[model samples]
Target: MIALLSAPSNLGLRPPQRGSVPGVSKAPEALREAGLFRRLLDDGATDAGVVLAGRYIDDDDARAPGHVRNEEALVDHARRLADRLTSILDAGDAPLVIGGDCSLLLGIGVALARRGGAGLVHVDGHTDFRHPGNSDECASVAGEDLAAATGLHWPAIADIDGLAPYFAPQRAVHIGHRDDDEELEEVRGIIGLVVSAADAAVAASDDLAASVVETAGTGYWLQIDVDVLDPEVMPAVDSPDPGGLGVPELTELLRRLAPRAIGASVTVFDPDLDPDGRFARLLADVVVDALRTLGTAV
Candidate 1:
C-alpha cells in the first residue's frame, strides 16, 4: 500500500496562490478541492489498487513570520511530519508526499531513518549541501536541506527530533545538477555521489527498469525536486535550473523505480512558481504512472 500526503507550502518561503512554477502543476491543491481522496477510495474499492491515505501537514501557516524565521520550529514541524509519515512507511506502505518545499526532505529522511537506513536518490539542479556558517548565502535556510541531511551546518537541523543528520553521506546521490556552485564542495565533503545532468537524462529514460533495479538494490529513498527538470519543461519552480532532464525521461525513471523500493516518498516543491497548469499535469502523470507501475512489481 502507498499513501499520498500533501505538504504544499514552504515554511520559510511563502509565495502567493496560483503561483506555481512554469512547468509543474498546482494539482495538489486542486486535488484537495476536487475531493481526490473520495475518488481514489472508490477506485481502490473497485480495482484493489494501491491505497491512498491522503493527509496534509496542518502546522503553523506558511505566512506566519515567526514560523518562517524560527529554525527550531521549522525543524520541529519537520519532525512531527516525519512521525506521521513514518507510521505509514513502517506499516510496509510507501508514502508519496507532495511537498511544501525541499524542506519536506527533513521529514522524509527522518521517517526513513526510523524504518532502517535508506539510501537517497536526490534529483535536483543543486548539490543542496551548503556548509553552515554566518554569511549572506546562509540566510535562506531551505537552500541547505541536503547539506543538513548529510549532517553538516546548522545545529538545529542536525538535531531534528534527535534524528540529526538523517542520511548516510555515501548512500546519497545527487542527480541532474547542471548549475555548479560552492556547494559542490560541500557535497563532496559529505562524500555524496554526483550524477550529472547528461547522465541523468540518459539513465532516466534508457534502460530505466535496469537503472531502477540497480539503484533500488542499494535500498534508496527517491526524492525529486521539480526544479531538476529543465525550466522549459517545468518552468514554475523556484530557481528553475536550465538544461536538465525532460518529462519523458523523468516519468520513465519513476515508473521503473517505484516498484523496487523498500518504501518510497516523493515531494514536488515550488509549484506556485509555475504560471500554467502544464507542469502540474506532468508531475501528476509521474505520480499516477509510478503508482500504477507498482502493480507490475507485485
Candidate 2:
C-alpha cells in the first residue's frame, strides 16, 4: 500500500497573498484549495491494485514562532515528522510526503538512515550544501535544508534527539544545475557533490529505470526540488533559476527511479510560486508517475 501526504507550507513563513510572484496569484492557496489534492487522493483510493491513504500535516515550520526559521526547531520538527513516517511504514504503508519546504527531507533522510545506510538521488538546481557559515550569503530557509541533513548547520537541526548525520557524501547524488556561480571556491568544493547535470538532463527519459537502478545500486531515497526545472515551466518557486530540467524530464526521471529505491519521499516546495495551480498539478503528476512506476514493479 502507498500513502499520499501533503506537507503544505502555505500556513507558515510564506507570503500569505497571491500575486507575490510575478504573473501569478493564488499559488500558495492552490495547494490547499485546488483539486490537485483530491485528485491525488482519488488516484490512490480508486487504484485497486494499490492501496493509497491521503492526509495533510497541519503544522508548519513557523508553528513555533521563530522556530521555522531556526535550524534546531526545523530538525526537531523533522524528527517528529520522521517518527510519523516510520509509524506509517511500520504499519506496512509506504509514505509519500509532500512539503512546506525541503527541510522535510531531513526528516525523511533521518528515518531512512535509522533503518540502515540509504543512498540519496537529489535533483535540484542548487547544491544546497551550505554550511552554517554559508547562511550569511543566502538566508532563504529552503536553501540550507540539504546542508542541515549533513550536519552542516548543527544549531538548526541539532534539536532532534538521537538523530545522527543522515547520509555521507558518497551516499548522496545530486543532479540538475545550470546557474553559473561566482563562488568558485564553494563550487570547486562541490565537484564530487554533484553528478553530471548532463546525465540529469536526460535522466527522466526512457532509460530512467536503468539510470535509477545504477544510481540506487543497493538502496536509496529520492529527493526532488521543483526548481530543478526551467523557470518557464516552474516559475512559482521563490528561487526559480533559469536553465534546468523540464517537467517531463524530471517526472520521467522519478518514474524511473521510484521502484528501484528501498523507500522514497519527495519535497514539493514553492507551491506559492505557482499561480494557475498548474505547477501543483504537475507536482501531483510526478508523484503519481512514481506511484504508477512502483506499481508496475510490484
Q: Largest TM-score belongs to which candidate? A: 1
Tens-place lDDT digits, model 2, residues 1-298: 5565545432213333322322112332354465544665666622112111122223343345434343445545566767776776566555555555566677776786777657677777777666556545433346665665655555556334555567655556667766463332463464334544555675436565455455445456667776787888777675677777777777767776666555555554554455466777776666566554342342
The best candidate by lDDT is 1
Reference-based TM-score of each model? 0.76, 0.74
Worst 10 residues of 1 by lDDT: 45-54
Clashes of each: 27, 5
CA displacement after TM-score superposition, residue 94 of candidate 1 (Å): 0.8
- Give all candidates' CA lDDT scores: 0.58, 0.55
How high is the lDDT of residue 48 in model 2? 14
Error of 1 at 217 (Å): 4.5
